[model samples]
Target: MTAAILADALTQKVHQTEIDKELQALKEQAMVSGTEDSILVNKRQGAADLLGSLRLPHKRDEEWQFTDLSELKAIDFVAAGKVSLDVAAAENFYLPEAHQSRLVFINGFFTPELSNTNDLPSAITCQSWTNLAAHQREQLANYLGQKTDGNEVFSNLNTAGMTDSGVVWIPANIELKSPIHLLFLTVVDPTPIMVQPRLLVVVENNAQVTIAESYGAITTNCTDRPQQQPYFNNIVSEIYLGENAQVTHIRNQRDSGDSFHIATTAIAQGKQSRYQLIDVNLGAKLSRHNLQMAQRGEGTQTEFLALTTLAGRQVSDTHSTIALNHPHGVTNQLHKCIVDEYAQAVFSGKVLVPQAAQLTNAQQLNRNLVLSSKARINTKPELQITADNVKCSHGATISQLEADEVFYLRSRGLNDYDARHLLIDAFAGEILDQIPLASLQGRLRQCISCRTI
Candidate 1:
């Protein structure tokens, strides 16, 4: 079919009236909450208007070409009037019970009463995203949406709807001995509630800190509010790395079985700085993540790693972009997906090297394993290099276990299932090794092991 034909076909597609109404309400909320930050307000309001006019995925949207969200139009779920969380229910998702500091959120609202920070390092300061100083607002305003190109609709959607998300500051020259955990708990409701939790993290010059941003829905909903149901989660996180600063980040999203999630992350690395990301998406009806980075200074380095285990009819999509704009910057990205039953997974990795970014070193690889014929995987890895003095490469692979490898294991007295499980684990072991927390690492390993076995 020609382009004109495709356009005509999409124009004839139907959209759910409910999606239009929900979008209109979000726009009105944004207009009512006018901002002193003129740029932000304009972006938010304009984005809201754009989203309101969207077609809500007809057959022509190539980006959402693989999955259809027409069912999202039929749901009558409404967002709660006031979002809150029970303090007791908020304590269960912490890291191994061994983490020293934690900040909790229930249904996107910050729960200060339930947070514990006594275990924080003496030289460090940790506060709620709402409690940041006026001077800090500049950081959040400047870095929040500034991190990425907002390539997808969900990215712009997150930018327009979220206002209460927090800011994290690690002051200059401070090295922390403990990890800081930010926990988000979404309440289940009968009506669909769209929640976008935003984060702006700053690691000052020479500062060292590790952060764990964990997301999970309150699996058990109240019997009294059965009419209210669990909703969808859309989040965007942006990070800034100062010169010589080093940071480690872990983003784990394991929400309720029925909920949907979409996430995006953007990071900028400074000279001599190091940044790493570990993305583990284990839950959600349909989950997707977009990650990107810009090497704006010489000697900066970044590592991107993601591991996903999905079953049922669930699907996960990940797309990453890396740009090296200065000399001697380095980037390494690796991702793995394990699909079971009727699940599907997608991966896209792209690297850009500008002419000015000389002597850049970049590599990207995506690997996937499918456990059943009903499962499918799509992998695309590419590189765009303009610099003559650069070392850049990209690759991808998708397959099941090799019969010869399985035969060797069975001959050595191992069951076929055990042998297959071992190989899958080994494929993801590199990412699992980079996790610094011993307890979380072990838990993740066990989670993957059980599902694979």
Candidate 2:
């Protein structure tokens, strides 16, 4: 009996390792991949240690109760550090509006030759962290990894192995005439790859700028076989707006269907600032986005709009939070999801108004349209307000394409597919029209219309 008990104890110890062996391998990779004596070494090491000490969240966790990570447990992924890409293959993915002001990263490492920064104004600074000098990196030490908390485990994992980073700093009182775009493209490799992309956008007081971050792959045919393994993309974006700054941010993700994407956007708004966000998701076998924003000062205006379009057996989850801590705060948010076939989607949004946040006007709405009977949607809109003088409202709606509307379109010389596509396009156009760039808006409309079920 004593011998059996000792054997069981040893087995349990191995089973209870904080992170899986796959993640442990990544931690080891972080230790040896980057420069050893750089200014960011300590920060990377600290995040690595934190990642090593904590376990990945499971379905039992309240925040992740609706999403499952069991499928991720089946694969072994190696860190994709300092990899190269074919420039010709990556040329088509760059957006035209940001042609002269863009940064491109291949396999999470910034590619200088493919990026264009020659036309940027003197007041604006746009460069990859990999190309910065030691002193320049030191100047950024105080701002890096400062806004996120311990609850962001995936972000910590990303920081542990992240070697490529992009930075956009706008000087005070300077407004950029064009937007800056960050494009990250992943290529397939024989071994399963894990890529981490980090970005920091800082707009100084009285400055204004438009920024966009996009993630995708060179090809969309990664297989599960050992020779053509899948990939995982973990991205984190930190946007800081100084007092009176007006910023417009856009996030676009269209990865391969065989990939896994986990992204987080943390925004900090200063006094009397205005921040707007447009989030679009189109492809991924499994994807989750955590959007957190804080109104730290009075008279701030915040707006968030998200649209997710999925088909086949895809699964997508979006969780957002708006924390108003000051008086006279205002916010508006709207999220929409379009699911077809056997796909599933989840939307959870929360608005927090503390006692000090009197006279806050906030509204949250979630709308979902399911085309197939097998599709599933789980939505929750919550408002936690402690202020007596606040005007807050939250609601959700789940519905399908009405047959009568389809029939009306069909009678007007449109086929079944065209009719269905028209309805879906109208549904998505509400958010797509919010985009200021005509090129991007047209591209989104074409993508939605072509992917019609």
- Per-residue CA lDDT of candidate 2, range 1-453, in tens? 012211222132212243344334444554576533354555665675666455667889988888887776556666675667777787767778888899998888888888997768966779977666677678777777777656577887666555557999898899888888888888877676778789988888999998888887776432211123568888888889999999999888888777889998889999999999999898778899999998879999999999999888888999999999999999999999999898899999999999999999999999999989999999999999899998989899999999999999999999998898889989999999999888888877777776664
Q: Which pairs of residues collide in model 2?
A: none
C-alpha displacement of 114 in model 2, angstroms? 0.5
In model 1, the Cα lDDT at residue 268 comes to: 87
lDDT of each: 0.72, 0.80
Question: Roughly what TM-score does model 2 have, to 2 decimal places?
Answer: 0.90
Task: Residues 97-200, candidate 1: write the lDDT tens digits.
Answer: 43558877676666778677788765454665446555666555666577755445666666655545666778899887778888877877665666667777
Q: Provide the lDDT at 396 for model 2.
A: 91
